[model samples]
Target: MGSGSFSISGSGSGSGSSLVLDGERGELVRAPAVRIGKKGGGKGGLLDEKAMIALRNHSEAERRRRERINSHLSVLRGMISGTDKLDKAALLAEVINHVKLLKTTATEHAKGYTIPSDTDEVTILCEPQPANTTNTSFLIRASICCDDSPELYPELKQSLQNLHARVVRAEISSLSGRVKIVFFIIPERGEGNGEMGRKILVDSVQHALRLALERVNSSMEFIPRDSLLNKRRRVSHFESSSSSS
Candidate 1:
């Protein structure tokens, strides 16, 4: 013999009534209906306050998440061209492709071998923003030729970062105990007076980078100490042992 489950089916809210059960016969019983939020259900005003609040909170969180995503996407679009026309999904795909391309480029650049100039010289060129950039930024190239100190690159980069200049690319070549660094940089615009104060920026950056290079060179202890001597020591031609008087 099979036993039947005692499940109650009910409709309509604001009630706690159930059908009378006789064990031997079949009767339909209904459970009490609960409503916490206010809403129209057919002709009756039904409500589910708890569920409503939960749904509202979830919606608010989702809205905020979308806003954050859109804000980041806008920034990315500005950083890369041709992305403004894309939809959300397409924009994300383009960003992925862009990142992959940059990764491959950096890998290719690493294969190049170089030896920077041995002369202790610092050359910095600051290029004004082009027509495409709308005079909003500057492209600066700083090349420093100095003796190879292992800590030079990190210290140099940190110094520039401290000066509000963000490096875009660096070309480093070392050979024969000498090193050369060519840094392509973009200095922050807002750190200046809205538009670039060209001379002020150039002078300040030059001074800062020059100081950094000076510190690195001065701290290095690899230079030879013996330069001038009174006389050259002559090699003795005598085969036999000699006694000094």
Candidate 2:
């Protein structure tokens, strides 16, 4: 059957009108309008004009809040590696994983284990392995106190490689003119026996550290103590301002 002409009609409905769905006629018909407000002959109704305005303002505020949350979530989604998928669940999972990794990194650096205060010297500690322990790998911890430099870490890594040792794991931390590097290493197989391996590792690491220190000392410009303190103060001030903003 062809649809008949249906018109939606209402007047002074205020905020308390019930909508009737006429399924047979396929039309929405509103109930009789009930006037509510100062002129409605009642003291006050729950759905007064003032209440409707308040409700509208609340709805608009909530919509803006949701839009802000969605914008932040979209930025996070774009940061994930596989953003082409366009799946909310996948993006959330990636964000969660990335957060876990950051937490782990923070915990690992919570304490300065290798570097000590009042020590402006390069120190290396190689733990002696007990005969009973079956693990053939060696652990070497190195701490260097020097000014911040970009090439220091790579130079140290190259030194380890020159000794024919492979780094299994490394933890590196740097702060305020101090750097600490710890390495879990294993000698290249067939290079030398156990005793020879230890000797080679010690010699190579010490020589490399001395050479690195000499290079740093020669190239570094000596700054006055007062100047260093002023530089640190400026850096701290900048950090505080940035964090506050």
Task: Please report, in order, the local distance difference test score of every candidate based on alpha carbons.
Answer: 0.60, 0.56
RMSD of 1: 25.9
List pairs with backbone clashes in candidate 2: none
The digit string of per-residue lDDT tens for model 1 on 28-68 reads 43323333234544322234334334544554666667678
Q: Candidate 1: misplaced stretches above 4 Å?
A: 1-115, 133-135, 192-196, 222-245
Enumerate clash totals for all models, in the order shown.
4, 0
